[model samples]
Target: MTDASDRLASVRAGLDRACRDAGRAETPLLVAISKTFDADAIRPLIAAGQRHFGENRVQEAQGKWPELLAETPEITLHLVGQLQSNKAADAVALFDVIHSVDRPSLVAALAKAQAAVGKRPVCYLQVNIGDEAQKGGCALADLPALLDQARTAGLNIVGLMCVPPADVEPAPYFALLAEHAKRLGLAGLSMGMSSDYETAALLGSTVVRVGSALFGSRA
Candidate 1:
């Protein structure tokens, strides 16, 4: 088994190579997806110079945040999954960036929670580029209204996020997100994952939330 240090080094090398291939800068922020692993596994990665991490479940993040922050105060936590409106307050309290703000209700909840917490939470409006009804994202046609609502609610709408259909090439989906960001005049696009990040970079993703590629397969 690869040790944490070895795994991190290898992942960095791969990221560097991918950036070069995509003709992007070499220092793109890498958010280590630490959803499944416990603190013991995560500590080594933090020690290995990883400062950004992502989680999928609000409940899981709630359990991990304090311990991880206590051990490494500089780590940035991103909530990268479907966020329930009920958990919005907790998510606001714990995460630095909420990358899956998919619905108007959730956006309103996050805005209220941010105000209650007295901290502005950076958010990404998730777009369902593939238009998969089962997925958790705002319909493409509704993005303008959603963005307008978020602005009125005083949430800092920083960028856009999306997950492509698993079976197809992720480039088109990534391109669609970039186009949406351009249309909205947003500065960030949190797209890509373990399998298709290179394509994402080529398509102008400012942030790539990668797992498995960094931490190995989740259990």
Candidate 2:
């Protein structure tokens, strides 16, 4: 098993190499996906200077955040999975950023929860760039209306996010997302993962949520 320091070094090296190959500036945010891993497994990564992490399930994150925060309050937690409306409140309470706001109802719920929390959790409006019905995201055409609704509801819309169809090339969809974000004047694009992150970097991804490539396959 690779020690956490080795894993951190390897992942950073990969990100740097990817950025150089893509001719893109290295993104300042690389979120190590920590879902399914225990706090003990994550602590060494934190100790090794990893401050940003992504979690998939709300319940899992709910269980992890407080303990992790106790160890490192400065850590930035990102919710990088489909967020059900019922879980919006807990998500708002837990994450520093929510990268899966795919619908207006979720947006509204997040806004309400944010109000109660007294902090506007940075939000990424998930776009179904591949138009995959099985994916959790808004239709690309509905984005403008959703943005308008988010603005009206006082939700802080920081950017857009997407999960490209697995078998297809991800660059075009990533580029499309970059274009959409530019049109909307949003600042973040939370795309890319282990497989196509280099392509995503080339196309313009501000944040890449990497899991297996960093931590190896989960047990």
Worst 10 residues of 2 by lDDT: 20-29
- Look at candidate 1 and give me any clashing residue pairs: none
Candidate that scores best on lDDT? 2
Error of 2 at 24 (Å): 3.2
Question: What is candidate 1's TM-score against the reference?
Answer: 0.94
Question: Residue-wise lDDT of candidate 1 within 1-219, one digit each (tens)?
Answer: 247778777766766777788778744567889999888878878888889999999899888779879878888899999999999989998999888988889978998898898888788999988999899898889999999999999988999999999989888788888888899999898988888776777677788887887777877
Superposed model 1: Cα runs more than 4 Å off: none
Encode model 2's per-residue lDDT on 97-143: one tens digit a residue: 98988888887888888888887888899999999878889998999
lDDT: worst 10-residue window of model 1: 21-30
**Model 2, residue 136: C-alpha shift (Å):** 0.6
Every candidate's lDDT = 0.85, 0.86
What is the alpha-carbon lDDT for the whole of candidate 2? 0.86
Our tally of clashes for model 1 stands at 0
